[model samples]
Target chain A: MLRINTRSVQILGQQISHRRLSELSLLIFMMPALVLVIAFVIVPAAWAILISFTNQSLIGPNARNFSFIGLENYVRLFNDPGFWNSLGTSFIFVFGSAFLGQFVIGFSLALLLKYAGVLSRGIVGGSVLLAWVIPEIVAVYIWASVLNFQSGSANQILLAFGLEKQRWLIDMPLLSIIIVNIWRGTAFTMLLFSAALEAIPDTLYDAASVDGASRWERFRYITLPLIRYTILLDFILITMGTFSVFGMVFAMTGGGPLGRSEIIGVYIYRNAFEYREIGYGSAASVVMLIINLTLALVYLRFTRVEWSAEA
Target chain B: MHRSGNSLLLRLSEYGFYLPILVFFFGPISWLVLASINSDPGSAWQIPEQVTLNNYLQLVTESDLLLWMGNSTTLAVGTMTVTVILATLAAYPLSRVPFPGKGVFMYALLLARVMPITAVIIPIFSLSVQLNLVNTFTGAILILSAMQLPISLWIMKSFVDSIPIELEESAWLDGCNRLTGLIRIVFPLMSPGVAVTGLFAFLAAWGDFLIPLIILRSPTTFPIAMGLYRAFGDQGSVDFGFLTALSVLYSVPSILLYLFARQYLVKGMTAGSVKM
Candidate 1:
């Protein structure tokens, strides 16, 4: 019995060492990715957080002798009307373009495609995707031209019906961006929902219809519940994406006539680079990060419930 | 006859519903095309009396358009190569090998994805200045690849997970090691996933505007996005024809790539969400 125990112990020790060897090798394999991510993303993010507590500037007297001023920038941010306005604009943009416009329209289109023939699906899907695949700068330029004050295609169409031409960018800056964002972004939501919709078995719908269910009833009971997770996922992704949008809005309006179109991203850029207030900008960035993290946490909690229920 | 007539009416209504969407989607692109070729810039909205390609010619010859295209190509290709190689290497072990703190590592990748570039730009900008890496292709490539790593890793990990372990184990029994087994067996199986991930990385790097706008100040170093923005700033509202022409030229590469690789793109895009 003693000899057998010793042999078993030796085998177990070898097995454990082999496993450790493999783990070490795996770590080595992961080294490059880990190094790059740490160097570029993790380090810089930490540095930015630190800088947020200081009175740093890109230029002027503070450029040479900036000192720590803990929480002052955050306090200034809370009192600053510009920061508040930008936050408000961000929420409006996210709600308008992401929630109401993209989600509703894209899901509706996906539902519409379910009933349509293949030819119709191909054409409609292709068209919407064209807007999505074009580079952001190019898309912005195209939309800018279409919304040009005079001789623009939009005004031309409006005037053809004898409606007065309004200065789109100036008169309704936020709305114009919201519309353009909807156009550019709907395709992603459409595709996501389309994939989700296709996953539901047709037998469920067939059985419902056989039982004398109405179209609306079938959708309400069967489709929405089936796609609830997908809708949550899309909400989280699109909200984050739209919140980070800068190039599109910048090119379209440069945050516009008064800062009416200045979302958080543009606001940060304007402060950091344009106004040379690095510390103030970092403070805004920290706030933006916190808000995003909070939103994600709330949505993640909802998703967790869904996950547990499904499991 | 009554059922057929009902079906026909349904189909007609569906087509009608699609009309507005189609027009909205295509109208701007069609207008840009028209403006690009129109001889008379003043009558941009009207039918052209004569078609011309002078605007495109001038864009290539007079401006820094070609140089920007070169820069964009280098950035995109470099990003794709680095992202694919590093992501695949990292993903293979994460999927196949179990380790302590693995869950934490995976969560970190997700957190990285959630963190916006805007939040970190200040420090990254200052750091790049300190390192004297501003305006360098290597700097853009490194940052872009890092930014792209999380998604690429996620996608590749899923792909690697889908592959059966027995295949590699059999290769091991045949006197091959893990690296060789991976190269010989797993890579071919995951080629589609790799292609999709690479395509996405390319798209991200190519379409990036803000990074290059911040980092590359010299005209010769500008990517297409910065170049087009500079062009727009220079011309403003004075020359719609030139602007439209540049926009068309700028859009062609990405549009063509999308059309070519859409199947992979869509599959890769939804892989993470659907799996979750």
Candidate 2:
């Protein structure tokens, strides 16, 4: 078989072995990466499931010799109000940041950039993208200062307007994080929508205009349909992304003022790392894995269709 | 990519719309730049009467900021090297060789790429402990590189796919074996791909907080990210000057890289689907 055996063969005036080499070389090249993925990503994902059923801990005897306790961790997680609160907070975070904030703004920015001058496009796009490119901690620091109660930029602006300076992080923890996430994240959707929009030939829009379609009609008929898949893909990616945001919230609010902003990542961190309840944390992680995997499956299948359509 | 019928009024309206947006988008980060040089930095924004380098100097001279940055650099460079080498090796065959289960393999990679790292951190922590990789740069680098490899491999494969197969074949007829041809013919062309892939791997490793947080326990081993978090955490007396300066310093490399790679960023994030 050509798959493995590299016997003398010509296919369409090209030698397969010359380009692809033997299967031995294939194994040699792929083995290192495969081994790494297995060790880090694949094994740990499976092991988290195994650890979820046990009483593992970061400290004490259970750290090493932890035994299975059979569904107790899951049962406790279900009943625990903290876990429930964390899930609700996660949904709010994802919905607020991904749907309300990033998607809406990013889409608008993309649409605006489609017709804007080059300078406007560069500056606007660059500013939005700058927020994204910085490290997560830097983003947290920027927002923390901006929302700092006494001398923060937001408070200063409020005072300048002769208004009260509300305790932004303390009183509105969830909203604060949502705003920060939006600031940091909108660039992705903007870039995505921009690419999708650019691919839509202007001729279609002009033709629609000539056919007496209004602006909204042109957008609804041509633009929306063209970018529907991108919207779906963006949703899946940003949801998964925002849902796993640990560092930003962790560094900014510590998910704090009483778990008010404790998204799932912070929740898992609280349990596993902070509380040292490895088993309980692993249980939460299993749930997180399942949700993300389901989304990833949809992503893969959706992208497959998209790619095939392109071909 | 251009469209007709941009009336002057419409173009003016577009610029008008961008005013508030530019303010909103650009407003927050001004704190970082301002506070770092403000002689009397505070939580609130203030334009200083006198700009001072005291904060930057103190950080460089007094604190372990340099050490933390060095560790971060070490991790980033190590991760970049490991990831780029492995990704390029795998990508070469993946693009050319037709094999059984290749489709499944690629899908598995996509799955890995998208799976939440939060879901598996607990186990990864334990794995590091067992392997005696805890508090070690080797562990951090390997984990970060592995985490990056799924997408890096995908990106490199797409890059390879973009290269003409005929070139390799033509080189094959020139008395050069695969290695020489790859280095002589393919590699020169592949350097840009390598650069893009390596840059991303470096960025991911540099910006990562969770792995370093859980795996590296000691302050001595902390990256600038963890260091910034700790410096800000002594909540009672948080040093605004130090924290702001550190944030600015930590951000410079990533921002520079972004400016350099902004053109490629869209295609890269989209997983090499778009042609540049």
Candidate 3:
């Protein structure tokens, strides 16, 4: 029923040098995904760099016909105080949410959950994960009302405790967004660390105890060293993820309260879409891209080290 | 007796440490749930005098909730189909066949996954405009699928790696072509991998807000996420019932998927990070 010419290349009960899949078919198989990514991701990323030199507008005569304006947008961005403020806000956000809040709390939760009762793990771990799986807008909605001015749960709790109500989004916008981000993100690190912890054998801990090592000493000597790669990978992923957060802050504060909570993502949207300054926005995005690429390169290095060590 | 007392204290401290975290995480989510059923919901978390289904009913009868949900489902399904098909196709070759620069190509994919989507919005927007793909579900689906391709490929490649090549080789010995062997034997065995990839793609495209906001202009094309964002942003007179109900509706699919993929989440997250 089928052609046997290709099969002639392979004899029955005899070994072939390699599998019979052809190179042409493999290339054909890869073409669709390769085209999609190159057309969308790689092309757009490179185009952002090219357009950063132009005086493009979202609408107007310039939209149809724009001329190159080298370094003008970048020069203006570097000179502006607002851009500096946005950059600073973004770093604080990444540092606070990814490093201080999520990493510490998630790591602690994982460590505790290892020895925790079933009930405690069910309640605590369940809540953290529920926060994560909900849509970003839903998280934004929940937090917006939670930090509402007059009738928020936060205020009600404060009043019930006889403390003055603080304006969360307005008075302390930075801290507010940071708290929201940490709440949404802590689940990932917790899961990652829990799996890593579970993989380590009980014998390692038993050996440490037999050597008379203290709890802290055992963690330092064994746990940290074993999970170091996981820790590095987690940092790389979360940091980039946090850097790209836009919709939550965009809907909540619009990077307002006098631009106090304007992260870089919101700033790009504001400049490009809201203000119709595509060229300027492109310049800002180029800076953010550089930062992300740098992080990715560092990630590659760590992973490469692991790959070579495996060999 | 002394050792027993010390162990009891240790247990007490462990629960004590967990108590605050549980409270911090659950308090707000509990409020969201409670507010949804309250007849007259407010910002403050409180029990309603009597529970009512009026909010959910209003969403079904009055608003464009169904339309938005329909659009969201279309986008999600489209994305899932495209991402899964392409990823599976690409992964088969990568798993079995050796190609030039394969290692470099894999690392490039890792970079693509971590590259910030927000940073490339300008060109993506303009490209869509040029292609006349603006405001089209096809455009949005294509873009979303591209975004999800990197990690999905890794997941699929690893899955394909687990299925021994001998099974396929044996099929070939029976005069089966590679495509037929794949469709008949290999795919059935890798359904779990396909499910994982499909689930991730669905969750992503369903819950995404940014792509819809940029691509779609009309309310007719809005997804549930866009609806939720618009309703909640109306500061004139807050519709707590409707907003809370929509939130519940919006999260249902995600929560269902999470429940289904509970065992796979850890594996899914580490797919690209861990060496195969």
Off by over 4 Å in 3: A1-21, A304-311
TM-score of chain B taken alone, every candidate: 0.91, 0.93, 0.96
**Looking at model 1 chain A, which ten-residue stretch has the lowest summed lDDT?**
A302-311
**Whole-model lDDT, model 1:** 0.83
Which whole-number lDDT from 0 to 100 does residue A293 have in model 1?
78
Writing each residue's lDDT as its tens digit, candidate 1 over B44-92 gives: 2666678999989888778777888899999999999999999888888
| Of 1 and 2, the candidate ranking higher by lDDT | 2
Recovered fraction of real interface contacts per model: 0.52, 0.60, 0.66
Best by TM-score: 3
Which predicted model would earn the best lDDT? Answer: 3
lDDT of 1 at B168: 75
- Worst 10-residue lDDT window for candidate 2 chain B reads B267-276
- Ordering by lDDT: 3, 2, 1
| Candidate 3 lDDT, B211-237, residue by residue in tens | 999987678899888888888787877
Q: What does candidate 1 score on TM?
A: 0.92
Tens digits of lDDT, candidate 2, B1-276: 134455666777877878867877888777788888999988876687789989898899889998999999999999999999998888877777666677777878888988888889999999999999999999999899889999998888888878997797667666666777777887778788899999999999899988999887799999998898888877797887888888888999999987777767777777723231
Could you give candidate 3's per-residue lDDT for residues A22-66 as a string of tens digits? 534656888999999999899999999999999999999999899
Ranking of predictions according to DockQ: 3, 2, 1
Candidate 3 Cα deviation (angstroms), residue A59: 0.6
